[model samples]
Target: EPEVTQTPSHQVTQMGQEVILRCVPISNHLYFYWYRQILGQKVEFLVSFYNNEISEKSEIFDDQFSVERPDGSNFTLKIRSTKLEDSAMYFCASSAGGVHEQFFGPGTRLTVL
Candidate 1:
């Protein structure tokens, strides 16, 4: 089965640097999303994008964050200004449609000092 793939399974960064995490979703899926889980917290929805623009974004997705499909197979999440609070497991997900089940990537661990 095709799986969503995320690069740099783990990363360590300083509190004020920029970080860009990459993902490649399943070929036939649509409706991509990004979610984060702080160390011991529940998964929090960050943003959802479709048709090249943001469809929905949660309160957690602020000015520091951005998402883009830079190419046909790559989707990326960039935190322009990282913070200690930004450390978490970021998962990339996609679904065939809004009503279908979402498949998640293994997740990229971002750690800010």
Candidate 2:
């Protein structure tokens, strides 16, 4: 089975800066999602995308966050401006469709100063 993959396993950025977390979800999956775990908190959904458009997004996913599939295999989350509260482990996940299990990436740890 193919697994989701992410780059820059660790990222340290200054507050108010921009960061783009990259991911390559399982090739065959049609639904993609972005989730984050704030250190000790539970994993929280950020956004979900399908058919090259955003399907849903949480309140936490404000104007500062955006998702895009620039090419066939890459899905990315761009944080226009980072804040101290934004530090977390960002994960990428993909599912074949409804009711299917979502395979998750190892995650990119973002640390904002």
Candidate 3:
């Protein structure tokens, strides 16, 4: 079965540098989303994209963050300037439709120091 794939499973960056997390969802999936989990916190939804546009976003997705599908197969999340608080395991997910069920990637662990 096809699954979501994320590059650079782990990343280390400076606090103020930019970072782009990449993910390729299952080819047949329609909706894509980004979620993050802080060390001891619950999973938090960041944003969702569909039909080439943002369908929904949480307060965490602010002016400093952006999502894009540069190509039909790749979905990307860009954080303009990293912060110590931004360090977490970011997961990329996709579902066939609506919010019924979502398949998640292995997650990219980002460390900002």
TM-score for every candidate vs. truth?
Answer: 0.97, 0.97, 0.97
Taking every candidate in turn, the Cα RMSD to the unseen true structure, in Å, is 0.8, 0.8, 0.8
Give one digit per residue, the lDDT tens place, for model 1 in 1-113: 89999998998999999999999999877789999999989999999988889999999999999999998888899999899999999999988865658899999999999
Please give, for residues 1-113, the per-residue lDDT of candidate 2 as tens digits.
68999999999999999999999999988999999999889999999999999999999999999999999999999999999999999999999978458889999999999
Query: lDDT of each structure?
Result: 0.93, 0.96, 0.96
lDDT of 2: 0.96
| Candidate 1 local distance difference test against the native | 0.93
Give the runs in model 3 whose Cα sits over 4 Å from its true position.
Answer: none
Of 1 and 3, the candidate ahead on lDDT is: 3
lDDT of 3 at 66: 98
Residue-level lDDT of model 3, residues 1-113, one tens digit each, is 89999977999999999999999999999999999999999999999999999999999999999999999899999999999999999999999976669999999999999
Clashes of each: 0, 0, 0
Q: Give the TM-score (vs. native) of candidate 1.
A: 0.97
